[model samples]
Target: MKYSTVLSLTAVITGYVLADTPATCSTTGDNTPIKSGCCPRDPSKRLRRSAREIFARTDSPTCPTPKFYGDSCCTHEFAKPTLDKGTFNLQCGANGVADIVNDAVKVEIVGCDTADDLTKETCILQISSTPAGSITDTHLEISTSAWTSTKYPTKDPASWSYTSYCVKTTGVCQVPLNKIGDGASALCDKKLYIAYHTSTSDGTTSKTCTGDGTLIPGQPGSRWWEYLTLDFTCPKTCDGWCCCEKPVTPPPPPPSTQVCNIGTAFGYADGAKNLNGNPVGPAVCDTANRWGWYFATSETSLSGTLIVGAGGNDLTKGTTVGTWSATITGSDITFKYDLYDDNTNGHFDLSSVHVYASCTAPTTCAPGKFTFKDDTLTGSSDTSYTKTFSVSGGTCSTYYLIFHASVNQQIPSTGTCPTPAQ
Candidate 1:
């Protein structure tokens, strides 16, 4: 039989088969009704009762009745709703079936200030359902089209395409939304989560699904979709001396040395005697057992001179006396005088003695005098004596001459000696 004819016959049979009482069978050759089962006592009542049952079970019955021989008993349908396209069917069922299409997820941005460029802006989009509740195969075709004051929504998405999918199990399909400026002449709006589908048991028709998203104003080229708010401002730059640099420190100066010039000089008078008291020895005078001259002087001036001298009457030679002269130069001055006895007499004698002299200053004279050694000088036929003196520093000065002569006789040795006077 033809497909349409078979369907009509099956519908009629199914209607009668569901009745409470069974119908009797008609036999062609026997000329009598087969009474294997009870017949419908009232065809009109049975037909009315069957019609009521069909009508009552019409709304989403447990199993859909097959329209044709090979029609499926279980079936499913799907539809998608979007902001721009409204609602439409993605799939249709064989029987009269109706299912609700979940509302489209929405994304919007609010609380934005255009004047404060660095201020954070916030946006919220309501998701129809939790994304994690969806199965792994579920996916959403989410796309956003922005309209600047200079642009329109009718423009193709590829021109400013910012599209993604809600395949991830976490987070809202709704995008956090934000804009740079206020809606002066045109509003900045976006449409998100346009389409979505979930895998089903048949692997053909998708399950029920919905999504939402939001958009946030963020720094350019940043992962802004993840954040609910963002701050926008011009980048900072460094120039001139603002960069990282260290201050320079100067090195310490070298150390200095102290400078000074030093010099010294010394002078002495000789009072040494051998065999007899006489000036006979080195210019240096002995400090013991003899008559000698000692003098000392010092000055800090750069240049000077000094002088010293001694004279005395001789007892061996009456009316006879002599002197010696000593001079010094530069910043220092020194001199020495010696006395000797030419005669072999047992008397101590001194002759013309000029002790010291200074060329730098003739007016300034150093102290000069004759002194006997603290210890006694004793010799049977020989005796010795010496004297010494010195002058260290002095300014430029001249030296004057002075001298003294003396004689000491412990043993009387008479002799007529000529006196040397100066």
Candidate 2:
């Protein structure tokens, strides 16, 4: 007898049998009921898939769907506000409100040359959240020692808001400190942390919880300012290399002077000392105590007066007393002497006068009767005698003269002495 048997192909693969249906087992053999499992169509082509696959997606989706990489992709783009990455401290400037990029924060500082109370100043604030809040506005104020916060819902004023209680602490509090906003007033000089949180209208909240960007006095020409609404401006500076420096002026050198003396020892005369136009000293045979003669000084040619016997008494015309004079020319020295008395006592008359010149001292060291053969002064018209000498500054020496007297003719009533030629 032949027996017919049936088995589920997915359950027992050894019971493999050929059928006309797919792996879903839709077909049955010879009037058999189809409610049970059936054989697959191609028993050798491939195994059939069942409805109970473990890793496949089913009627329900996964809790968190995979991030979309499909056409359902979205893009929300916004240019960031102009950010100042440098010091947040605003430099000194004309007083006014200063707004950071896009009104992110409004820092109003009572600015002026006369600012004293900082409490009256706008707290330096930088909020990276929704600039404006609707339906409610929350404020967190930090001061040097304490902090206060006030919350108001939509259409509610902060002053009349329901949240009236403010907690004060000696230190700063982090953002969302179980509060909408929290911060502390930091000393301008001291950098402090301030954080803010603003609830979004879309059931989202914004945070601006970090700012050591302390506000400070602006400096001229520094890059410490962004959009300044001040009446004043801080100076700006740029990187540059020094090109030139100022040159120093030097002082002038001192002047140089050369001097030449008059007279020798004993019968010595000092032309610099004997000059009468500027008489600060007396003249006599007084060389031991003071020089009595004057010296002639000239850078090129000699030109000055010198006297001998400056202490001698005066005499009548045509007679030599002792006081004598010499006027200097290029190379010549003219000498003249007067008498001791002309009061008719005719006490004395000069027989001759001597003038001397030397490149070195003494022309011959002799104290007795020095002579250089000076011209006689015998006249009633001009009693002053004039002469000339040639003396270079440092080269060539000087000499002195003495006068000798005896009886002489009466004064010439008419004829005057010849004017010496230079």
> How does residue 271 of candidate 2 score in lDDT?
36
Per-residue accuracy of model 1 over 173-226 as CA lDDT, tens digit each: 443333213321122222232333333233444443322112222323532121
Q: Score each candidate by Cα lDDT.
A: 0.25, 0.27
Local error of candidate 2 at 186, Å? 99
For model 2, what is the error of residue 130's alpha carbon versus the real structure, in angstroms, after optimal superposition?
99
RMSD of 2: 40.9
CA RMSD of all predictions: 45.7, 40.9
Best by lDDT: 2
Model 2, position 131, has a per-residue lDDT of: 34
For model 2 the TM-score comes to: 0.19
The alpha-carbon lDDT assigned to residue 99 of candidate 2 equals 24
Give per-model TM-scores. Answer: 0.18, 0.19
lDDT of 2 by residue, 1-422 (tens): 11111100011112222122212212322333222121222334223433221111111111211221111100111111111221222112222234222323332221111112212223222223223323233333332221222321122223322123222121111232112223112222232223222222324643222122333223234322212211111111111111111134568863332211112211223333332223443333323333223343332223322222234221121212335544545455555544334455322333333444534323232233233443353432233333444332323344333322222333333534332111
